[model samples]
Target chain A: MSRASWQAFREGAYHTLPLILGAIPFGIIFGTLGPASGLSVEATLLMSLLVFAGSAQFIALGLVATGTPVGLIIAVTFVVNLRHLLYSITLMPSVCHLPLNWRLTMAFWLTDETFAVAVSRMAPEHRTQFHWYYLGSALAMYGNWQLCTLLGVTAGQWIPGIENWGLDVAMAVTFIGIVVPQIKTRPKLLCAISACCLSLLWHDWPHHTGLIAAAIAAVVLALTAETMGQKKETSLKTGSKTT
Target chain B: MTEFILIVGMLAATYFVRLLPFALADRMRLPAILENALQYVPIAVLSAIIAPAVCLPEGYFWIDWKNPYLMAGLVSVIAAAIGRNLVITIFAGMATALSIKFLIV
Candidate 1:
């Protein structure tokens, strides 16, 4: 409520503007796919309101369309969102000193975009007002998502066969955008390759179990690859010292 | 009723995964191996999702060049690697898919 907090909040929201723009199509695509995938408008809106995790929601939609069990869907949602645990760990230093209510609200609002904007803008001295700036970014993204979902839902109803038009390519491509940049190292690249290939091989598995299996396999493989690389480097250094 | 339960379950799963870490942050000491594993979860899960959606767009093995999703997905991957921009990657993929769908195949 103070002037400085208000200014920080505005700056946080402003810095997040580009990310908000990137989310527009993504949000609309979710909205349209919800109804098309046999979800009621109420349920779709409520998912956006409550779950609020885009990738998980998209995966849920795909599973729901295939009549997968709700338990499996929720499990997949949990696995897909495990990355949030890492994000919270990284931001813990910045937010640990805050009150319970502030931390809880901030945790709920913590999306990929807000994390990027908040982490980059946070300073040790500005710790007190940083949550306000985070609030700005979170609120901006939250509002933008809800608005885009509404538009897509309305458009889905108005546009005939829009769902059949393969709007899911948006999600596929978006996933590509997300995964490609993160594949900088050999371990990450192999992880992605293994997951991609395994999912395809097990595509017909019941209950969408293939996805979970593939994800688990990829993570384990990456961890092993990383450990092996570390060992090789250490041994090489030791060998040079002895010689 | 089923939908309601599912949504509540998802809400609980997502919210708790996020909130529990913060509440327990003081006592939490994630092992280095666990941290490394967690880092790869996003890429692995997302790649799992993307591979099926693109490679089997029609719910079968459609790896042909004419498969619009496959072509566009490749384009998007290139765009993402080269441009490293979300909007451009999405636009490039969308443009390629739409063109191939309407014009070529």
Candidate 2:
């Protein structure tokens, strides 16, 4: 509510614009596909409103179309979203000091885009009001999602072949932009490379289990590299001291 | 009614996983090694997601050099490495991908 909070909120939303743009194509496509997949219009919109997770929603849509059991759909959604658990843990330190209500609200809105934007912006300088900025990013993404679903469900019929436009490339490139800059160390570079290779090799795994597997493996590899590097440095120091 | 149940089930499943850690944040004390791993989570996860999006654009491996998505992804990487601007990197990649899709191959 303070001017500073409002400014942080706006800045958060501003930084997330490219990501927001990236989601438009996917949003509209989800909207159109919901009905085509035999989901009632109300149910599709409700899923977007309540679940608010893009990947899970898409996977669920595929299952629903195949007439998969509801229990199976729910289980797959949980599995696919397990990656968010890691995200929640990673971000816990930053939000632990905030009130429970704020944390809960943020947890609900923690999509990939919002997480990417919020984590980068959660610098010490903005420590006090970073939640406001996060709220801004989350709310902006939420609003855009709803609007895109509306466009897809209602107006999507009028625009043919929107899915083939390859607009989803926007998201892929945006992610590259976000991740490449973060690769400042050799360990991180290897961690990312391992993740990429593992995910590709395991791409066909059901329920996006591959993504979670690849991420965990990559993290473990990076930790090993870091620990080895530290040990080498310490050993060298001890040897020089003896010399 | 089944659809309603399905929706509620999904909402519960999705929200619970995301909320559990935050709810326990105060009590959760991660080990130093795990904390160190957390730093790599973002890059690893994003890279994991990006690989399939580019190479498996058609839901199967298509790792050709001429794959437009691959080409555009490389451009975005270079742009980010050189420019370090999110907006510029996205624009450069999008322009490359779209032009190749619409104009060339």
Give the number of the best model, judged by DockQ. 2
Worst 10 residues of 1 chain A by lDDT: A114-123
Per-model fnat list:
0.75, 0.86
* TM-scores for every predicted model: 0.76, 0.95
- Candidate 2 chain A lDDT trough over 10 residues, lowest sum: A118-127
Instruction: Give the per-residue lDDT digits (tens) of candidate 2, residues A13-49.
Output: 8988988888888899999889999999999899899
Best prediction by lDDT: 2
User: In candidate 1, what are the lDDT values of residues A28-52, reduced to their tens digit?
Assistant: 8889889888899899988998988
Misplaced by over 4 Å in model 2 are A123-125
**Every model's DockQ, to 2 decimals?**
0.58, 0.81
Q: What TM-score does candidate 1 get on C-alpha atoms?
A: 0.76
CA RMSD of each candidate after superposition: 4.2, 1.6
lDDT for B1 in candidate 1 is 91
TM-score of chain B of each: 0.75, 0.91
Indicate the DockQ of the complex predicted as candidate 2: 0.81
The CAPRI category of model 2 is: high
